[model samples]
Target: MALLGYARVSTSHQKLTAQISELKSSGVREDRIFTDMMSGATDEREGLQRLLARAEQEDIILCTKMDRLGRNTSDMIKIVDTCYKKGIAIRFLENGLSTEGTMGKMVIQILAAVAEAERERILERTNEGRVVAMAAGVKFGRKPHQGSGMALELIHLDTPIKLVMEKTGISRATYFRLKNHQRRS
Candidate 1:
């Protein structure tokens, strides 16, 4: 029955001090606090994964906010659901709620729903922006093949493929493709 603290900051510029202080003030042990200074969009965070895996039945998993748990609502719900199934409790200390009772349960559901809606809205807006950009003749991703001559020159330089890639920052596939395209033309 440990009171585990989970703290996160989305980027290097942000500080985890406030979150850590809050958790500590709530009686969370220093050793029990796990943190990740990475985007919540990724599940590959080592500290976060370890905290999730180490949490056990009747343990309290505390976070500064819902967003710290995940980038969106579905992911938050998935993490909460997993904890519930394990008899582990989730406490969003800032929100003053826990998955330990009815009101907390309701709040969790509402938050999750809102997060999911927000994710959908973001995707919709991004797609609309892309459409607008396309209609305006703006490019969205990598630039079109304008450096075929340079690619061919680099390929003929007697450099190893790895060396060429290191120098050009282009993958071997792209290098070969561009060289072939230039030869064909």
Candidate 2:
């Protein structure tokens, strides 16, 4: 039976160094570990899909935490139940939880519910804070691209699109969009 590992980060910019290191230190090889640079809430994770497909009877799936596998109870239970049915086991290193016995399965279900509640609370708090900030005149979305204006100015001077992109670091798509905006004005 293989000791496979799965690691995930909520966003692409977040590093998986710590998770990978922990998995390696737990005796899982680097090559045996699967990683996804996406949110735990998303089901479109290629790495997780591949890992789940590869796991077989008696194999063990290792993760740092339950939330790393999924954010909500339903999703977490689904994964655990899938492994359980396949005669596979899952060991979560964070709290020393494993799906090797009836007690372990019960604990996982309880913890899954708690973790899901915690995630909901976090989202609620974040949205409330954002609302307050917006009330105080703070912007919520990304600011306009910094180089967009300069690129547009150069383009207005009849500069080549490629030259403008090279000088201002703006993409061709953005140049066209901004150029179209300029024309409409």
Candidate 3:
């Protein structure tokens, strides 16, 4: 019946000190606290993996917020459901919520739905912004390489394809395509 703590930040630039301190204040030992400095969009975090792997029946997993557990509501619900099935409980310190009984589980479900709705709203707004930008002729994705002109010049000068690629950091396929396009022009 160990009490475990999991803390996470989306980027390396973010600090874990606050979450660690909160967990410690809640009686979780430093060794019992696991952390990851990565996005919540992926479940590939080493610290999170270790915590889940080490979880046993009746264990309590604690986090500062629900988002620390996961950003995706479905994924979060699946994780909670799995833990519940394993007799493991989850507590979110900031929200003062826990999954220890029927009511707690219900609260978690409501929160998950709210989170999912918020995510959907954000996605919709982002897509609308993208559409507006595209309608305004805004270009997205990688810009043309500045070295392309140099590569073309080298190709026109009869430089070896390998040498051109090396000098301009262009791939073999790109070099050949540009070379052929140059010939056509």
Best-fitting candidate, scored by TM-score: 2
Off by over 4 Å in 1: 119-185
TM-score of each: 0.63, 0.73, 0.69
- Candidate 2 whole-model C-alpha lDDT, 0 to 1: 0.89
Give lDDT tens digits, candidate 3, residues 103-153: 898799789789878988999999999999999999999776767899999
Of the two candidates 1 and 2, the one with more favorable TM-score, higher being better, is 2
After superposition, candidate 3 runs with Cα above 4 Å error: 133-185
Q: Taking the tens digit of each residue's C-alpha lDDT, what string does model 2 give over 1-185?
A: 99999999999889999999999999998889999988888656899999999999999999998888988788888888888989889999998999988889889989999988988899999999999999999986767778988987997898998899998888888899889998998
Better of 2 and 3 by lDDT: 3
Worst 10 residues of 2 by lDDT: 140-149
**Global Cα lDDT for candidate 3:** 0.91
> What is candidate 1's lDDT per residue for 1-185, written digit by digit as tens?
99999999999999999999999999999999999999988667888889989999999999888888788666677787888888888888877878886667668978878876887899999999999999999987877555545556777775677766776677778887876776787
User: Model 1: C-alpha RMSD to truth?
Assistant: 5.8
Collision count for each candidate, in order: 0, 0, 0
lDDT score for residue 112 of model 2: 90
